[model samples]
Target: MATPRPARAARVLLPALVAAALLGGCSTTVTGTAAPDPAPRPTEGVGADPVAWGDQVCGALLSYYQPLSARPDYAGADLPGIKDRLSGYLGNVRTGIDTGKQQLADAGASPVSGGDQFRTSIEDLLNRTGTTIDEARADVDQADPNDVPGFQERLQAAEEKLRTIGAAEGLDQLGATPRLDKAIAEAPRCGELDALTAPS
Candidate 1:
């Protein structure tokens, strides 16, 4: 089946949505001047070494979306080519999530309170998102030309669910820590994903 063309919004927003989930709801605000070579600066948040840890995790996720943001057209001129590209895109997203999970574990960054719960929640969320992306890719691959609308509906629904989860977890509130927030804002690649996806 031929894959349906995505709307302008979807084309722009999809990468940002995935990037946000991978960042554990980190803010997309870019502030200050990014260092020519910004290393993760140490930050003191609710947990031990939360800043450094968050930086590492968020950085990894953002890096994945950075290249996508640079692409003028995620969907190429050919429909079949677009489907193939999307398959590769989903695979990359899944790999990034897996790598981010490993980085989080290795960094041992946990909140001061409910550390285990927090870590579990994050891991579960990442895993679920990866699974959903896999499903979306399958749907894309198998979609008939007439099935494009349905596929789009399902994809949007999945994205909405992810947004709800992030909000419920107060990911945007991570900016409460001024220093950490600043660090995140100043990170060179922090807002790149969102910038590309945001509506003009």
Candidate 2:
């Protein structure tokens, strides 16, 4: 008996189609165009744009210092009143620490040489201040109206701590970093920061 024509064609065409499909599956799709290269990261020694970095740093600092800018006066308040104001003040400082940490992190690594060290020191300072503030708040919470002298003393101590808790230290750090100092001086946002913290 003669081989069926359709069967013979199927044997021939099936393998060819399978092979073509397999090859197509293995082939990569082409767009006839090359993709753009990614941007290069700054090298270890290389710094970021000084003015831009300064702007970021100053902006972050400003936000960090905002909560403490205007302190609540507890001048004539009695023990309970004083405690309330003091607690509120310490709470603001705590909030400032939280705000500042986020801002600093958002500011990212310093672009100038030795900037990282300055950033680290500032962060450490903030952390320490936060711990101190927490302790002060606890003291305020536990203060006894019966012990007038002790309560006043604690309040005085907390006020002293607040006086030292503002943005001067961060400015001093900037001064230590000469390049950053210059950059910050040139940064417009830093100018706003200066005005905000300036003696009124």
Which prediction has the highest TM-score against the true structure?
2
Candidate 2, 67: how far from true, in Å? 2.5
Global lDDT scores for all candidate models:
0.45, 0.53
Instruction: Write model 1 residue lDDT over 85-115, tens digit each, in one string.
Output: 6556667766766776775566464432233
The prediction achieving the highest lDDT against the true structure is 2
* Candidate 1 TM-score over all chains jointly: 0.50
Which residue pairs collide in model 2, if any?
A: none
Per-residue lDDT of model 2, residues 1-200, tens digit only: 00000111212322332232222201112122333323232444223576676576556555545655545555566667756765776687688778877766766666665456555665776676677678767866777777987766665555444444432234343323445555656777667666654433
How close is every model to the real structure, measured as TM-score? 0.50, 0.60
The local distance difference test score of model 1 is 0.45
For model 2 the TM-score comes to 0.60
Off by over 4 Å in 1: 1-12, 15-51, 67-76, 111-121, 144-200
How many clashes show up in model 1?
0
